[model samples]
Target chain A: MTAGPPSLTQDEVSSSPTRCRILATAERFFREIGYQKTTVADIAKTLGMSPANVYRFFDSKKSINEAVVERLIGEVETLISRVADRPGLSASERMREIILALHRDSIERITAHPRIHEMVEAGMTESWEVCSHHVERITAVLARVIAEGKAAGEFRVADPAHAAGCIQTAILRYCHPVLIVRCPGDVAPPIDGMIDFLLGGLRAG
Target chain B: MTAGPPSLTQDEVSSSPTRCRILATAERFFREIGYQKTTVADIAKTLGMSPANVYRFFDSKKSINEAVVERLIGEVETLISRVADRPGLSASERMREIILALHRDSIERITAHPRIHEMVEAGMTESWEVCSHHVERITAVLARVIAEGKAAGEFRVADPAHAAGCIQTAILRYCHPVLIVRCPGDVAPPIDGMIDFLLGGLRAG
Candidate 1:
């Protein structure tokens, strides 16, 4: 129940050059070819280190994958928290920005580095412990905004946590990597329109 | 662009006993041994017919799978329509019943015959044309409820079709067969609470 991917602390990444070198090489191979085909041997070879040496730093290939994915999600978590905690915006405005920022970040990242996106997709489909934790953290960011809204009287929801959970579910079509890929070409409602409709519902009183 | 599964009309089912027998046998084989393992030849052997004869009715094994899956979804379609059209209920009450009925029906069917649910899961995951049409029909059923709600002053939505589409996307966690399997035993919020939150949003203002 307590299982989650271990975070690569700044001290460790900065202190251990070999571990950082392995991760950087692994990320490059994942981008150039793909995560599925990329192996720790290839990363080691690319870094001019033996595979056993690579294992000395990371326990297994799966751990390397977890670390790489965790790093990507960590960046998103940091960015979202900043937007959520920024001053001088009403809760509604902050909510809108945070949602749009997440969407834009996901779409842009996937559009730019589709191979990297594939790695993330595999992590999610495989139900990696890290991916589950990442989703919980993102939901927490939205919950923070909703709680602020309740305090400011900008939102009338009874439970901020429940409302935030519902909002995350409602917007998965727009924010989810797989759904975002499939939604654009179809006759389904536009993302902006759907978001406006949701904001309308939230603002309704 | 114009591809979709052929409909098996009641007239056809009643008129052609051989085709009906084939579908019934295929469904049984799928339930027993799984869809991935069930084959046209196996179905033919079971029915004492040639594989060629089986193909005479269904274009391919995939089509047979589609028809069988379609039959299952068609039953749901009918039940949902009945729930939507039943008399003496306010549109709000009708909407609640219809949504709950759908969630219950989907969950119960998946729970009851998990093998059959696997076939449904395959159809949805593979982007089968029949599955797309089936979802479109279900959305129409929800749209009818929303339109009635708008007309009865039970809902203030401007666009029933759009609202219905949004509702379907929002409730995929509870109603989607695959998601239902993954949701329980996790830290995610409960389905009933999420639905209550959605209903509260819908009832806003």
Candidate 2:
């Protein structure tokens, strides 16, 4: 049979608007109550659907949480990608903005809903691949900026990918959700100072 | 009063051999059964003392945990200080050794008893001062090495204290007990590469 616009697979067909509604309701419950307390029945009740219907879309609450976490990661990745591709900004400026954005995003989320950390923690424990994917995507964005800087003679790093990993790891105190919420004492240096130190590393001969 | 030999105060008198035995037993319980499960009763039972007797030394399990955490911190600080004070090594070498010692210590503790993180988590939650003091002491040791490196013209950082903070913060993934235990995926760069990057920042103009 000639391909007339490849047919939607069974998975895609089942991934309907109902799935989006379930995730939206589940995310609200996770943010408001907590990941541990939010049950599949609670999500189903909130969405005006049966628990079986919710299960048709997501096999378990853990899977639903993974989807919610994926959505949140997508938002952050999009924000960073926009910063990375912004016009008229040098690589250093872009790098600084990207780090700040990550910090601000984390702080805003925690401030807005302190229990949001519970969801993220659950994601880290139960759905590590989702968390790991976010890290890899973020590192890729940083590596892209470093590669551009190296080509433009703005940085002197030997391995942009490794340097990007170093930068991401270095700023975990500022950006990681668990850290930002748990350690509010500003144990690390201010974000600007950290970015400066990382930039110095990139610029070193 | 005459300037005679000083008398031991009540606090000093009470901090006796019994106190040391209590702490030693509590540390073992924390390591084996985990912190939350090891109550004041368990500690008292292990040391063949009444709960009230244990309380005479430490008012609560939290205080005992604080003391245990303090002792653990002391060991790490002593290790790092020795690395910092080695006579023949350059400042960079000392810094590298210090960081490696920290990583090795954390890895060893976790590898030997994964439940040890429970005690640390309790310390972070219940005895933040003990934890904060440990951070300050570690930072102080790192700052001394950085300061010496700057004076010897082996590094070019402007503020050794701030640079030391940055270095400690940068290596958290490898050193922080919670992060090391929770995220075992090696998401960050290897420790040696991370140290080289931080050293590059220090040596940069």
Candidate 3:
């Protein structure tokens, strides 16, 4: 099938609306049929465009997946930054809110659209730079809050970066989409208690 | 092509030497050809036995993988228990050793034989119960140590089990075979500092 209308400019195909349409369509297919089963041709067919036109926006199928993941991570990163930038809260309090906010946002996204969860799982195994970049940005935000805490004499961390990394690692099962599913639940541990433990660990010596 | 010996009794197949032989052969093939590439038939061929005979011992390719994983996790469990059971060392000290031992052992195994790393990566995504069991056992060991510390007033954790879960998650990057390869390394955070951070957090409030 032809890409909608021949009158549509090449620039229009590369515009934000086109890009957004592609992602929305891809996400729907991913949810309905799963990431591995869904193909670029399928996405294009559903979008009523030729696969070649879809390529003009996303270089490869992998790029489309990466873009999808980037979009997901970007949303979380924005929420985290807002929590970090909130005024009047202590660094420890801010960090707690940031962590909780991250958990809430991720769980909500994955629950509403399970396909994004599958996309993340694939990204992790493939060693995608997008996933790594997402992790790096999150860790950086945590470290900044940590460094702020250290500056304010709220924490006695010798290395804010290291502490941030350790904290991220500690809360991974709660934060990581796959681990959240894999870790046992029959003997559920209180996440709030775990958070308190982590916060306690971060307290000034 | 054929069974090594029809006369080989069930008792003999279950014997330590036979089990060791099969594992060694499987590990060698896994390393050489990769986990997905190595088949039960291939393993049996290497052992001069029929795939049926191989199944007689391990039940399935998935079971064989589980045994291999169990063998790896068993080594770490032994080490963690030894550290926990050691007399005279404070609870915090035992925990430090346990975490360090886990980090060192996992990194060494993955580095020496990268193929097992791939096996683990696959196991995680495939939702292998054996992998989940391995994580559970490790977390249990950590919980026991935390409980001992709490009893001795070495830690102020309200919930030892929860603390253990969080600790395992926090150090997952250092402990998980695949994550060790994924997380950034130029700014390698010292595991000791993290142990200290965890210890400080667990200290009497």
In terms of DockQ, which candidate is strongest? Answer: 2
What is the C-alpha lDDT profile of model 2 across B1-205, one tens digit per residue?
5443345556764678888899899999999999989999988888887787777677788988998999999999999999999999999999999999999999999999899998988888777778788888999999999999999999999999899999999999999888887785667888999999999999983
Model 3 chain A: weakest 10-residue lDDT segment is A181-190
Candidate lDDT (C-alpha), each: 0.75, 0.89, 0.77
In candidate 1, list every pair of residues with a backbone clash: none
Where does candidate 3 chain B have its weakest 10-residue lDDT segment? B180-189
- Candidate 1 positional error at B83, Å: 2.4
lDDT of each residue in A1-205, candidate 1, tens digit only: 4343444665775479889788888877776788889888888888887777776678777778788888888999998899998899988888888888888998887687767755765666554577678878888898888888878887877777777777787777667665555334453566666666666556552
DockQ (Cα-based) for each candidate: 0.31, 0.60, 0.37
Q: State which candidate has the highest TM-score.
A: 2
**Residue pair clashes in candidate 2:** none
Q: Scoring model 2 with DockQ, what do you get?
A: 0.60
lDDT order, best first, reads 2, 3, 1
The lowest-lDDT stretch of 10 consecutive residues in candidate 2 chain A is: A1-10
- Tens-place lDDT per residue, model 2, A64-92, is 99999999999999999999999999999
Q: Residue A167 in candidate 3 has what lDDT?
A: 83
Go through the candidates in order and give the clash count of each: 0, 0, 3
Clashes of 2: 0
